[model samples]
Target chain A: MLRYLAKKLITLVALLFFVSITVFAVLFVLPGDPAQIILGINATPEALAALRADLGLDKSFWGQYREWVGNLLAGRSHHSIHYKMPVFDLIVDSLAVTGPMALMAMGFAVLISLPLGIYAARNQNRHGDVTVMFFTQLGLATPEFWFGILLILLLSVQLGWFSAGGFPGWAADPIGAFKALLLPAFALGVIRAAILTRLTRSSMLEVLREDYVRTARAKGLRERSVIYVHALRNALIPVLTIMGLQLGQLLAGAIIIENVYFLPGLGRLVFNAIGQRDLPVVRDIVLFMAAAVVVVNFVIDVAYAYVDPRIKIN
Target chain B: MNTPLLGIEELSVGFDTPEGKARAVDRVSFALERGETLGVVGESGCGKSVTALSILGLVPSPPGVIESGAIRFENSDLIGSPPEALRRIRGRDIAMIFQEPMTSLNPVLPIGRQVAEPLMVHRGLNRKEALDQAAQWLERVKIPDARRRMGDYPHHLSGGMRQRVMIAMAMVCRPKLLIADEPTTALDVTIQAQILALMVGLKQEMGMSLLLITHNLGVVAQMAARVVVMYAGQVVEEAVVSELFGRPFHPYTRGLLRSMPDPAGRPDGGSRRLSEIPGIVPAITEAIVGCKFAGRCPHAFGRCREQAPGLFDIAGGQRARCWLSRFPERRRTDA
Candidate 1:
């Protein structure tokens, strides 16, 4: 198992390297001037040249690439021309809002969908099954931004249960921050829960038909225990696969929902950085998203080993 | 032998398909006495397994239902019993083990949990106590290092060992009746003998009645006291194991016996071709007015095609469903 994890770790590093290079190449070719965006029209040529040199914007393409790589390896971050702060600190601040929201959305998805899916599969073709399927279909159909707007309208605008948008700092007041993030988290979570429930239902249908489930019933286990303990645990490998993919999607897909809720997040930072031609932040954050996906996939592979002992990691 | 432990009266289990109702088990009736092993024998699709499933209340319902029947166990009718009542009886008064040992257990759960399930359910023992008792049961089933092996998953054990674990799980609660459906069909030849021996040994040790269902006549001879011979969803004949082997009354039973190639019976002391029953076990999707096995019975006659034969007693608790065994004057008898 250790050897398998070590191999995956090496692959993850290689993949991150490839992703960083791709992000750098794509950003380099885009038509933009960071110095121009930072200095504005009133700046003199001398001031602009000094600013360009200081920012490393005046270096050759390869020279700038080498400097970025060196700074990354040495644990230093270039100053963000847009934020006027260290890029690391800015990225971390944005993620503080985005990370919890994504995790909360994920927890909501698992808690809601796992049972819904299993219940639908068990009831299968009855009224309960049809109702759950109908809602999941509707959830899958609606867009995340539209869902977010709908939640804002219902909870924030109409009910006045929550403020309309913008995050209060978590460190300032944990409860208020949770309340502020709830609507947006639920909004992002609905579509994922819909997709996950469908996957869970189908996967559960297959596992429920397995011979082992019959034996479980023959043991006189309660129908509920048979479905949840025996059937659900076996059905998890496939559901977990879909969940791991959805997590990376949540992290990257946060941009639109974050925009809708006015929640400060990394996706938004990357979006604004792209328009401002802030090279360091854009490249780093994109790399981070790809790394997030790769890391999540690796963790999922390990989880598979736990769910099914028959799976040999090697 | 006088008082029966389980009695199935005119049980008809069918499935609803697009075309019509598919009668998988047609009006099957039989009885098993206390501490007796009654073997239900037939070809692969002959409804032997269905009968067992129906008794255990495990058959899938929408497509499958008990069209008509009564299953009397311990003075209570199990056929239409409430789920709560059935749940209480199942694995406490009665328990079942299936054919595929390798697949009949949860692959993820530890073996200890699977063995202790019945004890926890029926006995209401706590997890730790149940597990301790489960370890002892595993030891009785001859699993080495029983306590330590409790942590192993189903996939970690060999097929024979898995079957032994399945047996351990089935017997943990000391059920009054134990139904084993083709329990040894999927094992190595030598391992088959050992598992069958272990089952018989366990039955004797616990003094519990056993319903041993198998297609193998050889297996029935070793494990069963009396045997019910089924053909195309109906019981064609039933007798003491020796009586059925010595003199098979129905043509179907005769064909089943002839199909087995005996080395001692070979002509000129050399190998010879084994006789086979000509036709497969046919399905019952449409209405039937005559004997279901008449098409495959070599001695099928004019009356055999016109009406189903009733089970008639020949002697000493022996019964065969055939017109040829009855007097030529006998007619219109139905069971």
Candidate 2:
């Protein structure tokens, strides 16, 4: 198992290296001039040349890439033109906000989806199944942005239950931060819950039909135990697969959600960096996001073996 | 003999399908005495498993309706017992082992837990106590390394081992009656023999009656005292095992016997052109104005095609559902 995990870690590092090169190439190859964009409209060719040299844009493409990669590896400080802060520091700050939000959203999604999905599956062809299925379809059909807007309108604008947008520091005031976080988390989580719930229901329904489930019932176990203990464990493999995939999706979705909610997170940082053509900030955040996704997938792979002993890593 | 342990009188099971209400088991009646093994032999969709499920009230209601029946277990009516009362009876008074051992044992749970579940539910034993009993039952079923293997999941065991776990689960509660629905059908010939032996030994030790449902004549011959031959939702023939084997009255029973390849001799061991019953069993959806097996019986005549034959006694402790049996002349002429 250790050998397998080590191999996976090595592969992940290689994949990250490839992703970094691609991001570098794409940003460098773009037609727009970051230096000109940074400078005012009255800037001359000499000023442009000077600004380009100062930003190391005067170096050859490969040379610039090499220096950027070298500086990152060396932990050399680099300023973000967008935030006017060190790029690494900005990444860390943004991650602090985004990481917890994504995690909370995922937790909320799991808590809501698993039970609802299992219930729907057990009560298949009944009123509960129909109702849950209808809402899940609605969630899958409706975009997360629209859901976020609706939530803002209902909870923030009309109801005045929550602030329209922004994150309060949980360290400063836990109660206030929890209340502030709830709305965005709900907005991001509902869509994810819908996805996971649908997946859970279908997978559970399929697993319930397996022979083992029949055995469980024949064992004279209560219906609840049969559905939850016997059926759900096998069903979770697919649900876990979807959950892992959705974690990455949630991170991507956070970019739009954070922009709408005005949350100070990595998603917003990435968006702001993209707008300002701040390659350093963008590259670092992208790499971090990529790393997060890879790590989550690795964790999910390990969890599979735990959940299902039949899965052996050779 | 002592009053039968289980008696099903005029039992009928119907399902509400989109097409229409379809009868799966029609007036299926049988009795199992204490410590007796009654083998119910039938083809697929002959309502063998349905009958077993109905006996335990495990049949899904609404769609699956027991239109009318009296399932008397030791003179207590189980047909319309409340769910809670039925729950007590299910694993305590009567237990069942299903076909397809792989599908019948919950894969996620340890084999020990699966075996101990009935004990916990009915006996009210805690996990440790129940597990101890489960291990004992596992040993009864001849499962090796019973203590260590108790923690292993169902999928970890072989087909035969899984079935042994199933039997252990069923027998753990020490129920008066045990229903084994094709319990060894999923196993190899050797494993099948082993399972049968384990069941026989356990049945004798516990003095529990058995209702063994199977399509294998060899199993019926070896394990059963009484044989109930079912075809198209009805008992076509029922008799003492030796008598049934010696002289099967119904054409379906005859066909079943004929289909069995002789174990002691080759297929063509001087038996004049091996008997082969022509045609398939009629679909349940088809209206049964006449005998259900009439379409397949060579001796089927005008009366046989026009009216269904009800089960009738032929001799001491033997019965068959066939018009030819009503007329000895017809039987002789046909022969």
The most accurate candidate by lDDT is: 1
Candidate 1 TM-score versus the reference: 0.96
Give candidate 2 regions above 4 Å deviation. Answer: B60-63, B266-273, B332-335
Tell me the interface RMSD of every candidate, in Å: 1.0, 1.7
Per-prediction DockQ, in order?
0.79, 0.54
Per-model TM-score, in order, reads 0.96, 0.95
Q: In model 2, what lDDT does residue A304 have?
A: 87
Q: After superposition, how far is residue B214 of candidate 2 from its true place, in Å?
A: 0.7
| Residues A17-135, model 1: lDDT tens digits | 88878888888889866777788978888888998898887888889888998888898987787787988898789888888888889999998899899899989999999999999
* CAPRI classification of candidate 2: medium
Q: What lDDT is reached at residue B119 by model 2?
A: 87
